[model samples]
Target: MSRTPDNWLLKVTGLTKIYGEPNENTLALTGPQFGSNICPETESIVACADINFELYPGEVLGIVGESGSGKSTVVKMLYFDIEKTYGEALLKPYANAGVNTLDESNQKKRYIRNHLMGMVYQNPRDGLNFNFTSGGNIAEKLIMAGNYHVGGIRERASELLVKTEVPVLRMDDRPSNFSGGMQQRVQISKAIANNPPLLFLDEVTTGLDVSVQAKVLDLIRELQHELGIAMIVVSHDLSVIRMLTDRTMVMKNGRIVESGLTDQILQDPQHAYSQLLVSSLL
Candidate 1:
């Protein structure tokens, strides 16, 4: 998809996440060049640094890297699951894209998360309430976004379940009773319950069986096409990235080493790290 400044749904600049106290040279000392995110000077961990990107509406952007490559950290910071040490992210639908979402107050951040964004984690437990029925989990998301009509909530929940290929008969069962794949489907349904423009998926199919993974990925593709929801998909699996994303960002040791059209990256990766990844995928 063609992306212009005015057409971007989300703009992120200089996004950095570091753990522990760090001095001025922390970021400089850690990255792909050093082959480590750990700063020798201050012992701080740079989960990600100087990340910049623009996600257009209805576009699927992929962050592909191996474990510890900081792909997940980027999305976690944007989703407010973790704090950013430095950076700014602006969502066009919020504050006319003038305010940095990372700087927003907690209450306002929650409001943005509830209404403008959604997340589906690799582990369903992190995203779903096992104690609640599958339908109830979706209900919680809807209710938080100000949906109070019980009948409407149920109707929407069932609709989402069916849309995601989850049997409506299982709606009343708790996540604990569902298979891993089923749990993920429920997680996805809840994530999109509010029809958020932006969604984040972090290694969502990592542990599923191969057949199950394909099903989940297919469902996700269907949802994206049907809802026109833009997504930031973080995955170590190149296949997952290849299957879902429009554009791709290759991360390694806390920095984006390469980024461009997914097909271009796959066919002719410029960065050595990215080349290694694409070659492995082939």
Candidate 2:
């Protein structure tokens, strides 16, 4: 995914994650590890291995595969939710002189997560502050991004809610009262609170009814177009990928099997797994 950088917001290469310790016979492992801390019964679980991709500003990249394909793991690593065992990712803005995010200080990583990146998990609970008011939820992010004025925060929060198609009057209510679709919208509103440069959506519409899923997906498309945010969307459903992504990557058993323009890959998948996925969709 790394060539010449022309307005690319992110460049990731060799991003990897393996649960548990390396196999006893493996020669080496990357990154820090306490070999003794691993559970004796656990063998290493390679969730995602050697993932490489890039995102141009405002482009939507989709990762699609059946469950346990390591698609979610890839996004989690980029979001810093899962520690990568090896590999480096570069966010162009912060990667001056080759600053690899996998090696960045925790403080800097936190700053990037709070200010430059936003995420919408399939479950609203993962992205939303369940206890906080809808408006307050967005304000939490704004506050972290260094916005201090209450009035400005409230205004922005309200704007985002309306933009995401949530009723402004419900801003004071907690997300616990919202329906599945409403909760996802509220989470979407909170994610874009700071107008972040990069956004991550992991199965954003996985469990919703068809109608509700369409609404959530539409809102995502609208937000991406309006905000011009580079985004990585991870979903097991190819339909979801087709609906929103510019480029798509197919994964299986912790590795990328195919990647290309969304339509091309969907219509003429090269990898055996990708072909099977497309056939199943039909």
Candidate 3:
């Protein structure tokens, strides 16, 4: 179910990120054509450039690339984890989509993050506070979204734990005490605590055991179906993209080489880099 231009949940245009001062030709000299993200003249890194996409409500979009390909940088910028060099991201639920979220004040960005979006990082430690118990983490998210009643917070936390297949009994335990897989499940529980419309998942199952990764992916699929949440999943693994995404963007050297429906990309990858990635799956 694709959305029309009139009803995109999130629209991003000219999304770019750079690590150092770059000259006008930085973007022009870098990317797939050069097989690098570095500018030879300025020695600056163009993390990603001219990224444009629209994610519809309940849609799952995949960004696939190898390490240092800037796939993670794109979402980090959108989620405000890292400041973008330049970009405009508009969310339908915020300011009627008239505002560029990247330019918003920090307080406003926090509000948007708490109420409109959620992010699950590759490392559970990045997303969860080790000092806080599982339930405490969820409570923090709920409180930020304005759910103040203690009883309500507890109940909601328990419910989220159950929804994410984490035992409610572990609610009082800190994530540091949980297994890697369990900690990730708890992270997912906390991420969706507010019922945000959009979620960003960065290599969510990258380090897990094969069986555990499958389980976590299944949990994510279940939650997306149950909550109708739109997601942007970033990963180097094409298999993960195949199982989870409706559409895919194949990226290399800080630029997207091709994009299309997931099935089509897998069956008929067009670009040389994309073909190499797809062949790796076989």
Candidate 4:
């Protein structure tokens, strides 16, 4: 059956990834063996499989799953950090009506991934360069993405800092000097610097306190409403998903077990895993 397009800005179908099998023969000679059985030379494990989802413009799609359920892997594939083993990940451009499909062979896909998509990692430290000033870190992405003119770049970066609620006075300070919450705001500013059409937020508030998490979540909602940016938020926190997302997908062992409107899924979850997740939240 043909799938119906639901105002989708991004669509993923049957996505899968398997690692550590390509150089099995070479590894067999030098790699440590587990007893006489030789460890069977099995692949590491499938990080994700049969992953399918749709993200619409201005919609926050929450991907909630336990650790190792491939939530991060899905984000990596979307960001082109890793290649998918099978199936298609079609990113429909905001300006174009046609889908821009990606696979292992396309260099153009990488360019699009880097420019059109933005990612906020779980750890703010991973996303922001501690050595550089907060403004420099935010301006760096814009520069790399081809927004090279000094005047505009500086102005936009300063504006982004304001938008993300980071004080303009601290823009010259290194990320290491900022509080955790402030550093996270800097990271958010960096992610949104280019006004990307789609953004992947991988547990962006995991390490923050409740108040800070609330503030960050509110900022995300405000940005989404203002910019109409499509977002895929990978978070295990059910409350985060419920509060910020319009729709949600519940995953387990690299597969989606339940998906629907956020309220419906939370209020009347069908899958056992979904029920357990919801119960834990309550």
**Best by TM-score, which number?**
3
Model 3, residue pairs in steric clash: none
TM-score of each: 0.98, 0.91, 0.99, 0.87
Cα lDDT tens digits for candidate 2, 160-208: 9999999999999999999999999998888889889899999999889
lDDT by residue (tens digit), candidate 1, 150-236: 999999999999998899998999999989999999999999999999999999999999999999999999999989999999999
lDDT (Cα, tens digit) per residue for candidate 3, span 152-251: 9999999999998889998999999988899999999989999999999999999899999999999999999999999999999999999999999989
List of clashing residue pairs for candidate 4 = none
lDDT of 4 by residue, 1-282 (tens): 122565667778888666656344422332112212122355456566677877777788899999877789988887877777776777667335354355434666656755788888888888889989999998889887888888898899889999999989888999999888888889989988888889889998998998999999999989988998889999999999998898999877666778999999999999988999999998
Could you tell me the lDDT of residue 198 within candidate 2? 91
Q: What is the Å distance of residue 157 in model 3 from its true position? A: 0.5
Native-to-model Cα distance after best TM-score fit, residue 62 in candidate 2, in Å: 0.6
Give candidate 4 regions above 4 Å deviation.
Answer: 1-6, 21-43, 94-101, 104-110
Ranking by TM-score: 3, 1, 2, 4
RMSD of each: 0.8, 4.7, 0.7, 6.0
Candidate 4 residue-wise lDDT at 189: 91
lDDT of each: 0.95, 0.84, 0.96, 0.80
Clashing residue pairs, backbone N/CA/C < 3 A, model 2: none
Compute the lDDT for candidate 2: 0.84
Instruction: Give the true-structure RMSD of model 4.
Output: 6.0
